[model samples]
Structure formats: C-alpha cells, structure tokens
Target: MSNDDGSMKELVEFVAKALVDEVDRIEISEITGNQTNIIELKVAKEDIGKVIGRQGRTADAIRTILNCAAAKLNRRYILQIIDE
Candidate 1:
C-alpha cells in the first residue's frame, strides 16, 4: 500500500513472483489503513504450495519481511495470502 513515500505493491509483487512458478498468473493488491497496510497475494492454484510452504512458514516469512521493511520506514504493513 502507499506509505506516504511510495507504494508497497512492488514488494508484494516481488514476493508473489518469487514464490510462484507461473509468475504471469500472480496478482498482488494493496489495502491501507491508519493502523497497517495490507498486501493481498494471489497465485496460480498449483503454486499456492510454494508460497505457503510447509506449515505456512514461508507465508510467515513473507509477512515478516513486510513488517521489517515497514518498520524501517516507520510504517506498518501486512501480507494477506489468498487464492482466486
């Protein structure tokens, strides 16, 4: 989401593309609020596993990265992984 300086959608796209084999099918959306920025990630059905990883560790890692970056900018962000 837009965090005053710039949009965090780029980060979402990068993460989604990295996680999916079918990069062309990946989609990322941003939702921002006073509290936090939400990044929704959608990928090809077959590649969902790659994004989520075993026990959702990979997904958590993505969120962690988002949070870390946001913290550096003195902003807040969240990554919401979805399938569509």
Candidate 2:
C-alpha cells in the first residue's frame, strides 16, 4: 500500500543526482502516519548543492510533490532535508 516508497526513492534519486555528481549513498526515510507523512533525506556534503538547488528551488519542488501526493491519499507529508 506504500507506493510512495518508490515515489520517495525516485524523488530522492532525482534530487540527489541533480545536486551531486554521484548517485550512490543517498538515503531517504519515510514515516507514515494517519495525520502526516514525513520524509527524511541524507546526502553527501559534496552533493548538497544539487539537493538544495539555487535558493532551494529544487527542494521546494520536491516538497510540493510530496505534499501533493500525500494529499491525494488523504494525508499530509513533510520533507525534512538533513545534512549527514
């Protein structure tokens, strides 16, 4: 029932790859809840720029997609981008 797992993975990869030259070692975690879904992302320092984009436009877009997707499922989602 968690198709978003794949969606989460895709989104993570997209952001990570866009922000960094390397594609490996990108980690994304999803917390499912009746009230809201939380997505945590961990990326390498070198690739942080790609994840955040110029003025965080890329990050904003990713969050928007997550919010939209979760809303379709009658839920709320939050994307938490962490540096680790």
Candidate 3:
C-alpha cells in the first residue's frame, strides 16, 4: 500500500473507532487499485448502527470526507461498512 493508502486506512479507522462502542472490534482493510481504492470497515455487530447512523447520514458524511481527501491525490475511495 502507498502512503496515501495507509493514511486513508488510518482516517477510516480513526472515525470508526470514535463512533463505535467496541473500538477493539473495529477492523479496517484496504484494497488499492490503479484508479480507485476500497476501504472495508468492520465493527462489532451491536455497534454497526452507530457507525452507519440514522438514514445512513453519518456513513455518507464519512464518505464525503474521504472523497475530498482522495481528490487531492487524484484517486477515488469507496467506504464499505461490513456488519459481520
């Protein structure tokens, strides 16, 4: 992973940890591609709702932040919240 990828992973992890009750259960994985990067986030079953928020607004906000950061690097980022 490139430094940008690592920073993106850290950004997701940091946000997820702040939103969830089970911080230790949070797991973040990144799949880097030529033009796009996928960041997969896993949290405890009970904390899924917190990360996603009502009507997915919180999740959307996170993605917006990620996209803004990715824009500076000329990349696209997708954040996938995995409940399992």
Candidate 4:
C-alpha cells in the first residue's frame, strides 16, 4: 500500500475506534487502485449508528476529511463502513 492508503486506513480506524465501545472490534482495510483508495471500516454492530451519526452527518464529515487529506497526497479515497 502507498503512504496515502496507509494514512487513510489509520485515519478512519482512529476515528471509528474513538467513537465505538468495542475498540478491539474495529477493523480497517484498504484496497488501492491507480487513482483511488477504498478504505473499509468494520465496527461492532451496536456502534454503527454512532459512527454514522444522526442523518449521516458524522459519516459525511469523515468523508470530507478523507477527501481533503487525499488531496494532499494527490490521490482519492472512499470510506465504507461495515457492521459486524
């Protein structure tokens, strides 16, 4: 993985872990492409709403941050939240 992918994974993992009760249950993985990196965040089922937040405001905020950070690296990132 490139530095951007690694950083994106860490960023999402950090944010999600902080919002959830089951920190140990948080899983973050990245799929990197030529132009985009997909960051998948899996969290405990009960914490999905917390990560997503009311009306998805939290999720949007995360995406926005990812976009800005990816821009600094001249890459693109997509964040996907998975419940387990």
lDDT of 2 by residue, 8-73 (tens): 657655756666665676788877777866778888777777778899998898888776766666
The 10 consecutive residues of candidate 2 with the worst lDDT sum are 4-13
- List, residue by residue over 1-84, the lDDT tens digit for candidate 1: 235425467776877786688999888877767877677888888998999999999988888877877787787887777776
Candidate 4 stretches with Cα past 4 Å from truth are: none
lDDT score at residue 14, model 4, on the 0-100 scale:
79
For TM-score, candidate 1 versus 2, the one ahead is 1
- Sorted on lDDT, highest at the top, how do the candidates line up? 3, 4, 1, 2
Q: Against the hidden true structure, what lDDT does model 2 obtain?
A: 0.73
1-84 in candidate 4: lDDT tens per residue? Answer: 656468778888878877899999998888878887788889999999999999999999999989998898889888999999
TM-score, one value per model: 0.85, 0.77, 0.96, 0.93
Q: All candidates' lDDT scores?
A: 0.78, 0.73, 0.91, 0.88
Candidate 1 lands at a TM-score of 0.85
lDDT for model 1 comes to 0.78
Judged by lDDT, which candidate is best? 3
Model 3 C-alpha lDDT per residue in residues 4-44, reported as the tens digit of each score: 76898899898998899899999999888888889999999
Candidate 2: the clashing residue pairs are 19-50
Clash number for every model? 0, 1, 0, 0
